[model samples]
Target chain A: MSSSEDSMCRAAVDEALQTVGGKWSYDVISRLYYGPQRFNQLRRALGGITVKSLTDALRQLERQGVVHREVIPTYPVNVEYSLTEKGRDFRAVLFQMRAWGEKWLPGEKDEKAEG
Target chain B: MSSSEDSMCRAAVDEALQTVGGKWSYDVISRLYYGPQRFNQLRRALGGITVKSLTDALRQLERQGVVHREVIPTYPVNVEYSLTEKGRDFRAVLFQMRAWGEKWLPGEKDEKAEG
Candidate 1:
């Protein structure tokens, strides 16, 4: 279904991994839940992403069923991206990952584990 | 902390990812949850994994306090691996990923989502 050539299963997992298996993916998608965002807006929200890396991530998510992209079609060519229904469904997973990550993934520790 | 030198956060996530992020990782860990498993047992349990990949995953998980490795030291040498408490904590997340993946991944879908 994608422009790239690969087996159906391999391609699908690869595509899904492209969205989920990375440092900043959940962070980026988590930010987009609020509303549609332009390219620059997303870069601003995701603090340390390089332009190329961010573009790659957004394109990958768009390929999956998770992201919806709208072309603003302005002079310089503006575009807005947001979550699709499937993408929105990932909100719960994202929250779980964040909480679990902060709990276990070093430095974000709350230190208030209930006794 | 265990022989790897990098930024602490980077090193930690890298170590955790070494345990979690891969093709056969979750499958291996999930299988170990049943009980302690020998090396050959794990290889047989995980149908598609190569020896190299399995060995690496086992070592990484061992380092992370997730997979406990007990050496039998028999004639040839035998090793058994099982999940630790922290590793067991990931059971819920693993179940979620498997279910969600089957639902949205390449295959493994249920027709009934309770409409």
Candidate 2:
């Protein structure tokens, strides 16, 4: 790539990272990728995440149009969260990261061998 | 993917992020993607980075085996930095990120339009 193109790519990558680079962002998104879930369900699925952290991550993702939040009226109002179309599209990046990680970063088996 | 598989992927992705997710890590790696460079050259290429930040980033990457550092034996010792084979392989993740960013994130043109 030309210098200008390289810079542009860098900026774009930075922007993407900024949007989804939070500590809990990937976990939240990955869970939602399976399907939508009630807020409580999501909270339960992501063990060890504080309520505040999950809330912040969901709100930030919603604001960025990467996540959708819906309120269902019932005896007790039910809130559901899911990946938006944009969020679903982000799977490519996640998949790529996973692939690279699998190749370069040692997994449990590799660690055992090393030990 | 199965739940077990998803969890494994998450672990791998997390490991990858932990290795390259530093504030300056991606910027440093992206700059080196083009080619190797001297310390000062890299520092200048990545404007706004403090010397300490660069030093820390390079050291961290080197420790992770993503970057290789070499010292030239000469009248004045010169140091050079380049990506390892593993680092070069990480371009796929970066490219995927760039594509996602281009699709979703607002660039300068988009910002101007909104303004």
Candidate 3:
């Protein structure tokens, strides 16, 4: 590829990677796709994730406009997160990825083994 | 979605995320897709990556069978990394992400401005 084309591809890919291909962003997006989930609820759904990691992930998604975060000014300040339209669009991509993974990278002997 | 379906989807999604949706793995993959690249070459291509982080990323891809590392039996023992066919399949995905980002998340005023 020409240097210019390559550079253009790199720029767009980098931006997209930073936006959605983040470490925990997809996981967080997957969790919120179902409905508006609260902070603790998201934390529990994404098991084994540290609080800081979850917070950072949420912040990144929020900044990208993929996540809708609503704060309920209640006794404890309940916060809920849901998917924006862009976020919902990723549902197809995520589902495709899930199918791809099961078909190609099924860690163990899925049903029948293949080399 | 049903609980069983959700669990299955989660499992497949998690496995896929671990496989290709890694932090710098796509960057590394993009660099290697053209041809075999040396470790230092990859570092420079993906500027600002720590040697340790690069090593860790490479190790992850190697473990998942996406990157194939070949050690050059030369005077200095140079090591080269390249992508497998399975890895090349993600080329389409990476390309799509680039297009998506250009349209949706272009950082600056992309060629034309949009709100």
Candidate 2 residue spans exceeding 4 A from truth: A1-4, A107-115, B1-4, B107-115
CAPRI rating of model 1:
incorrect
DockQ of each: 0.17, 0.70, 0.39
Model 1 TM-score, all chains together: 0.73
Model 3 lDDT per residue over A21-114, tens place: 6778877887787789998898888788999999999999888878899989999788889998767866655656666556655454355575
Tens-digit per-residue lDDT, A1-115, candidate 2: 6778877887878767766678889889988988999988988998888889999999999987889999999868899899988899988988998888877766564785788
Could you tell me the lDDT of residue B40 within candidate 1? 86
DockQ of 1: 0.17
User: Could you tell me which 10 consecutive residues in candidate 2 chain A have the lowest summed lDDT?
Assistant: A104-113
The number of the candidate with the highest DockQ is 2
List of clashing residue pairs for candidate 3 = none
Candidate 2 overall lDDT versus native = 0.85
Give the alpha carbon lDDT tens digit for every residue of B1-115 in model 3: 6766666766765665666567777678878887999999999888779999899999999887778999999998999999877667666566666666566654544556744
Give the local distance difference test score of model 3: 0.75
DockQ score for model 3: 0.39
Please, what is the whole-model Cα lDDT of each candidate in the order they appear?
0.65, 0.85, 0.75
Tell me the lDDT of model 2 at A86: 84
User: Who is ahead in TM-score, 1 or 2?
Assistant: 2
